[model samples]
Target: MAPFTPFFSEGLYQNMRRVCSESEESIHYCSFPQVEGERNERIEQSVARMMTIIDLARNIRERHNKPLKSPLREMIVVHPDVNFLDDIAGKLKEYVLEELNVRSLIPCNDALKYASLRAEPEFSVLGKRLGKSMGVVAKEVKAMSQIDILEFEKAGEVTIASHCLKLSDIKVVREFKCPDGLTDKEVDAAGDGDVLVILDLRLDESLYEAGVAREVVNRIQKLRKKTGLEPTDAVEVYFESLDEDKSISQQVMNSQELYIRDAIGSPLLSSTLMPPHAVILGEESFHDISKLSFTIYLARPALVFKSDAILLLYGGNTKSVHGLETYLLSRDHSNLKSEFQLGDGKITVDAIEGFPARNVVLGEHVFLTVGDSVLRTKGL
Candidate 1:
């Protein structure tokens, strides 16, 4: 809430400078952005409180270097009144959750448990009212108990040292208590009156591990962009890890495969190997090789494995296309007596009569059947 300011006239130069202010906020009662609509004080106050929560959450993320791309596990909101909590954790829940990127929201009424709430008389506002007794009033205001403060908040007034005081005569200050096993740096807190927003800055391994899939999607989209692929263009996504088998990239691929596919509007291929006759659009590596390293390739959908009437490699895992079988097969391509090469192992048809064209394997004599056309891998 902002206090209204009355207009005052200074010298000619000062008045001219005020009229030529660069920011509207610098001038009082500037209403250019205001729409001609009915104003509801209740709704307006609700929005103001909601925005305060959001602002504090954002400040925590920025100051602590927690990027919005990464998600957190939980947020603890504490206030004295349950109705106030309901207004936030109920009416305006979705907006806060999305903005904070927290998986869960917990509300508590014990503000005194997490913070020390006290009142400090506004010396400027009090000096006009009490004149000589302002100093005595200030000490009693600081020494006021939590119960006394909460009670005074409702009526917006209290009496200290036989002098009646109003809420405007003082300001409520909240000093949050830091949790055990955590330093002040690890916790961030800000309040609008009694509304206390506490954010734990520790990173959640599970949430971040899941977030890796989002990073993969971002990279794949970048690769798609580098190759000048259009939004409607359907391509295949391939992930190859330079590290261990159960690598971060592989885990994200396995866990968030569906998310990756849906985000880029493409299918994630099972096999990391390069396919024949496929136009290699582009390949990108994670910029931070020290922490995470993986290769992502974007290419035009070059081939499909349709053996036993099922999809192959990594394509089998995706269930978006119905009526298509999905399987991962092991093979031994030993003892093919004839030498053959057609469409660079994408196709091979012998000179024999009345023989259907079958897909061939290059390294091993493996043939993939795709209805009338066969994408063959030649045994090398």
Candidate 2:
């Protein structure tokens, strides 16, 4: 029990005892698991830095009361070490964007440039190191400029009163008050001397569209939970926009159509847009997101398959009887068929009728479903 106590949980021990028939009936009898590899300090440091960046973003979000689902326009990150900042930014740029609900991330040189910084000397470190000069050093440190303080933080040492001091020697704090040139629009930021994150709350048309897309996903997830649908089950989705000044309906269809399809496991199966008043399948609901209203419809589980055909070749140089016969032999030559005259012979293409087909809808637009076996749509 003592040997396995560190690695094995009670549940894991019970499971092991039940499953491993050939081994001893107790986890205590088993050997401890071996370590697989050596630790990489650089990678660990990079990850730690990334976590700090994420924490900074989270703090800003909390201060501004911005929900994680509500996507923001941008996040400005300022760090004293350019190389370290770039390493974290380049390595985990996408992760930051996703976790922070931000569209763009801009890395700046000194985050304190936008703020008024004051230096507060650490009495303990300064007193022990400088002794008699501590009082004089504190006065000098308090008078240092933001640039000098930043340099002190970055270099881990500063010259004050002819005495040298390092990071262990000082503490830098960002006050909540905004500095000059920062309007009421900007938010208060929190960070150590090393890193800072500030979020831009303003939203443009594209950002608004992205937010709506997130809402669509959220609503679909809620519907899935309410209806008790399996994760893989595909549901036909229908929606109508309430915003009039901008084309919310069109934006949802054009920008988020593919994402909506894949996320909910339901591709838009309709050949045409469903009218606003059209009766949508399954449990329906209404949502007001970012001051935009949407009437959403989710259809029952459907495994419907769609089919299409193309004329690979039109032989006989437009004048051959065989070409005409080939065109006539093609299946389902209804209103959907296309006819092209090449030379004298004609080529025809049509979608096969009577096959199980999918017709899904998103708002006022419908995706053309034409594939075999498993259905697929255009890339997002």
Candidate 3:
């Protein structure tokens, strides 16, 4: 499958490029400390820096194949601290009216905090009231002071853009087994050729950042090749906490570990293992699976794989097939009939009427008593 291409807006991309091309002197001069103490010096330095950044931005736009057509609606001057608010304001007014072609230079204490606040409906309403009190247009002033504007520009749109990499085109099969003194060779054989062996490395959430995930993928690929296997069929192992004493339950723990390992190892999958794929949903991650499922479907995957028990179904989609036995195995037989609604179609029950749901093991096919009759269904 082709690697996922990230999407970015043209305006955001151009703004970022301009910020990156700004000079170090200009950045340092406009930074909060240099402009804080002396009012006249701060204004002079800020205006000079703004002019330099704007000029570089224009040059980049003219040279690039794609250029920004629309001028910026506003320029927001962000200060690191509010101690020099008055000085910052004066500098902003001069720059907005003189240097940059923007209509205003709205001074914000923290740009990022402002952006986040503006995102809230309550803040939006309060902003209107505050704008009215100050005799300024509320919608015209948007905040983003907390973020280092220069750094944001340097990183480009990729930094803030959604980091979702749709892997619907990749195909994979999952094999489950309890660790039962199985040798590495036997496990490798079960993989049926080259396979990614994901070891559940139980790590704290803080350690699973993008950089760490990339590192893990690279390390796993090396391990796979060391065993004399192709890179695509490389074995990827992750450590996940299987013990119930840990916060995560066994099923949830297994699912999350598998998902993370699979995503990291996706780029290295062989053709045989590649299929349309979907992201694994961790517990307490997203609210609804239906939306996630829709996103996966839009990527054009034929089937969706999820370890969660709850399935969200929407109208005008392909009818889903469920095995009577499979459902019973994952859940207790008693809980099964109560957990799901039966359609008009005939279902085979595989357990006795009062059979406790927890005792039902996976892969059992039996008749279950529901209402006045017995129905048969497949188990997990």
Candidate 4:
């Protein structure tokens, strides 16, 4: 990163220095980074296979008009041995499940239910040896059944149409059987050369509503980007929907509150009310999920004065007070941009119940209890 920092951005280099607390201004002064351990070939191969599954699954979802926010029922994998998919699932299941938003992965050695393997001659390989007879052998291989293919896979050879065929002389291809109601018109199939992946396109009510929740998360994530919020800058999120979308939005908030909160990095401020300073998205931003539409609002938390003494009160009561800092700037500083601080206790908060709350704040997070109401600047 240091080598390319100068080419990328000077601000990035400055940020790296500030964040890493590097005394040296230039990273050219630091030692080059290096790998620390021996590479595990098995794990590397597994990860590659995992990536292939995710890529294929995503493509399947997109092609079938299935939105990424909505998760599907399952991923159907067809391989000669179930262990092929099971082995990959053992380590990388979470990556596939989360990335594809699928509920489960089902590995099958039996492809008869939804698919079957079709054997074909490796034309160039078998051509030289079989000569003119290759045409007849290719036809016979195409007509072979699932049982024949399974047996041939084990023995690596079998006599087909009274002609001897070896594993090296043929190629195996898995063809979809097309479940009921689904036509064989479109393949709806993807592969990574070794295994076949078919996504279950069947969607239920629960999954659709869950997708609505994810859509809400997606919107807030967009808002965070639109507002230029830092990754670690936790902003309170709010949402409001029209008369028709109100129930849907509330359902999303009620059911998927945890999911939305974790995704947005903030507790939902309110699902019913939109704040005065709330920035609302127009029709352009609403990528409606199942005819449901909603607007998300974002407000970066504000700490009135210094956040040090949130327990401070101006209600003429004696209480515990710390090094509370307040700024009294010039009358020209109405915009609160560039000012000189003159603390005369001008700002006051009379009604706020204090409680401890440790939050992830700033680039390098520090755990501290800043009162909740104090953070919203409710009284101010």
Candidate 5:
């Protein structure tokens, strides 16, 4: 963005002085005309010429090579009948930068269409490289109108408020409070033109991707008739962490599992590459460990597919390993105990309770067992 320059700056003043001098010369020439009728005609002609010169000068200044110097930038010329000037300006401002990168500015409207026709092949090639088909590219251009609506919402106000219509298959799991005199039923009603505001609240991973909050807004709109007379208004949906205890990675893992189950006919745990581990207990398993030492066990044999085999398990503290000797002695897994001691390894555990596993990818046949329970296995 360029710094603002005053209208009466040196360069502008010089241009204005030139324009005034040209106008004065024209007026003087007109005054000296010989015939009375000719003088009047000369005066009229001079005024018209002066006006044209001024208009040309103004156009040059407006479209000058200099950078933008004011927050109140360019004036858009549109048909006089267009009623939504503010709405259009607001939407445009949302997407267009104050100082656009040279390559970012593309012709719109008539100019865009003309350019597209002339560069059709090149456009097609570029679109294909970007993973979009020519038809899709054209469709996107046509969809600009709908996109503008979203832009308007984002730019016009910091908080979005709108009534939403519920989809038939969707359901509301919670009641969101609103100040627009809307009831639960009203918010849940199924209808068109229902307004709901989307607050810029940080959401849990699951809710964020699933658009649960947006669904709530739609439900509210649907339930309007049942609640009472519906009011046309917008509500802000603020971000609230739904699962604040869990880390982002843990939420992502859960979401991945859910997606797999819903779309691929198998849960993430059910996949052959990484099956869930089974836990088994023996009669003497509880008594073998020292109070201060704990055994780390794996159910399946370790298979190193990659250079490293890392398993991240969360939820434990120093106290967790304190009672291990007694617990192991009770369990009578002496062989397991011997193997754990021979590994000469480190015990890694978190001090707090939260989602602990992160970036854990297992290789083939690597089965991790804890306390006779298979913690995880390669290939479900």
Candidate 6:
């Protein structure tokens, strides 16, 4: 009966609806869910800041015509004072990556340093304190150069018409006009208080591959819905890209196989160069996207991979593998290198030639086998 009846709650109610069962007709008849943890305002503030940063990133994506699924190379968060974000940014870095769909989140000290800034007086706040002199104060503010505004804000006060105006009376706006005159996709947002979020809109090879992966995942999910496949039903995926350049299609399939597999509930996924001759006895689906197109063949589970061959200790996305890749370069690579704990089990993969393969694990038994070296990991 609640407005936010969760799926889990609905399932529980359905199971208990029978008279023979010791359950109620509906979750509304049951007690409210118990609170197992306490809420902290400090944590709330940190999360709020993270959300604000995400919103800022989304704005840049929208303005540049880049969809949320497409990953950007980098996003720079600029706030002279990111009090709550300081710790959260370090602790919850992965959340930022997935939410913003950016390869990296760079928290910079001065995001506005490269761009021009204009300070406009928040007339409502100014009028209340300055009375009729608000107009005069705004004019003085408009006359001030970008540097002057920065200096004024740093001082936290400005003297206009001999009246001392505190920082509360002024609002700073960051403009995307680059002083260096090099053209780039750039945008800025004024976040809570004086924080400004600036995003660098450029996609390198690595980031472009990530974006392609996202597009493939979206297309596959759409195909699954069109074919009326159940969410829990595992299916075999055969992807054929419409892209003329085979390299681009292969690169996406290579880089984002794990993501595609997890998203579509498929244990066995692959991109085929040659199209299947005819619609097999298998239930298959086909679809095309504007930028990226593919045909996905879905088949009921027949066990694509042997369980004894290779197994993931934990049932999770490949992001954990990506994290391991980053860890190898950092000083804190010791603990995770031995074993990565996920779900109910743990996985271990040794690095080869200072790098791991794009698809760390495939099928069931075939895990990473790099260059002549095969690091056998145990499945718990």
Which is the leading candidate under lDDT? 1
For model 2, what is the C-alpha lDDT against the true structure?
Answer: 0.60
Report the lDDT tens digits of candidate 2 across residue range 137-172: 889888888788777777889777888777877777
TM-score of each: 0.66, 0.63, 0.17, 0.64, 0.15, 0.60
Give lDDT tens digits, candidate 4, residues 211-283: 8777777777777787777778655666667556376667766777677666766556564443232334321
Identify the runs in model 3 with alpha carbons over 4 angstroms from their true place. Answer: 1-222, 225-228, 234-261, 264-380
lDDT of 1 by residue, 84-170 (tens): 688778878888898887887888887677888889888888898888898899999999898888788777788898988887887
lDDT per residue as tens, model 5, 5-85:
533344555665675755433222344446543356544543443333224323333443222221222222121112222
Better-scoring candidate (lDDT), 3 or 4: 4
Q: To one decimal, what is the Cα RMSD in angstroms of model 1 from the true structure?
A: 14.0
Greater-TM-score candidate between 2 and 5:
2
Model 5, global lDDT: 0.28
For each of the candidates, give the backbone clash count: 15, 7, 48, 0, 67, 3
Question: Under the 3 Å rule for N, CA and C atoms, how many clashes does model 1 have?
Answer: 15
Task: Pick the TM-score winner.
Answer: 1
For model 3, state the Cα shift of residue 37 in Å.
Answer: 39
| Residue 193 in candidate 2, Cα distance off native in Å | 3.0
What range of 10 consecutive residues in model 3 has the weakest lDDT sum?
293-302
Model 5, position 158: C-alpha lDDT score = 19
